[model samples]
Target: MIRSAYSLQAAEAEIPALSATPLDVVALLAQAHHPEAGAVVLFSGEVRNHNQGQDVDYLEYEAHEAMAEKMIAEIINDAHAKWPLKIAVAQHRTGKVAIGETAVIVITSSAHRHEAYEANQYIIHRIKHEATIWKCEYFTDGSKKWGGNCSCCPPAL
Candidate 1:
């Protein structure tokens, strides 16, 4: 099956853990499906309690969202440019999120499992590596720090 859909949102809400519901993602994939597609692949990035040995209490995300969405749209365009994708959608949450909550979701569909798998990976990698965004880590000790902006963080692609 070959379908067409894309979505992105940044919200302040309680993030789900363990078994989270990505309604937007589900809906997008449902739209993306085509009778010819045999597989769908989805990638979700969740909040974890530890980073670089630091105990994270929570996370605060900030974005120039209008531009961020534009860039995200570009990633989707690039993925489709590079792969045989039937459908693709990417959504990310912003604001305060606790440990073990979903932060991002990338879903891709294709005629075969391999295309879906590769497209999903490409979406996530681009989101992390190229997306114009920043995050701050809040620790149990009341310390806060920025990530993705510091040279200590991984280099941008």
Candidate 2:
């Protein structure tokens, strides 16, 4: 018998990996549902049109691909251990991202809404501050600025 994805067991669930392409929100959401999951939470970190009063033309993101992925997986695992999560997935873009485009995404599911919401928040915040990623902002005026993510180390020169 072919079981619905919603009926899949938690052991069948796996952590989502990091990526550098445009995130498919719909696909990610579809992967997060489980029989125990009554609540699903998604976090989309989009590229806004402006930042710091400057018009943003676009954003360029870079990362130590292997390291960032490892860190994110650890964070998600920690969340699962802390909460009753059925599944979790996260991705970060590594190339040019236009305005209103998603730069990062996190999805979490749990039997309860609070668990899903809290775990989703925890994963996104950890990715922002702990992952070895860098961001370069291309302003509308043809200027650019580089900064490290919340990681303690600065972007490599």
Candidate 3:
């Protein structure tokens, strides 16, 4: 929770239930210009029960916290460099998570909607594909599967 000229926001937490990533709060922070910034964009990525047609009982997510945070910081930096972003925030859940829980949220604010949207998308995409995080899947059959690179379970691409 380090505050900066443009807050550096990111977290790796255990998600057990519903999480609120309200646009207004994040937007207000990003749109420090508030009344002057008229547009905001927010994206929430939830943890769904099914993946590749398998019935997911729950998911266990693990990450190299230090590295993951560093990666998120870079993504935010890139978003700012690539867009007219006023504020940026991204969060991801770690540890056990149930179905329908939110795993990630990205919020970006700009003077315009277009820039906000682009920055939001960029942050989410990087978090999903580039973060140093891994997921384990528990299925209805009492079996489990791990992310592609996980050594303790089957490969999941």
Top candidate by TM-score: 2
Rank the candidate models, highest TM-score first: 2, 1, 3
Off by over 4 Å in 2: 1-16, 148-157
Which pairs, if any, clash in model 2?
none
Return the TM-score for candidate 1, rounded to 2 decimals. 0.75
Ranking according to lDDT, highest score first = 2, 1, 3
lDDT of 3: 0.66
Comparing 1 and 3 on TM-score, the stronger one: 1
TM-score of 2: 0.84
Runs with alpha carbons beyond 4 Å of true place in candidate 1? 1-32, 148-157
TM-score of each: 0.75, 0.84, 0.72
Pairs clashing within candidate 3: 30-87
RMSD of each: 6.6, 5.2, 7.5
Give the runs in model 3 whose Cα sits over 4 Å from its true position. Answer: 1-33, 148-157
* Model 2 lDDT-worst window of ten: 148-157
CA shift of 80, model 2, Å: 0.6
Per-model CA lDDT versus the true structure: 0.67, 0.79, 0.66
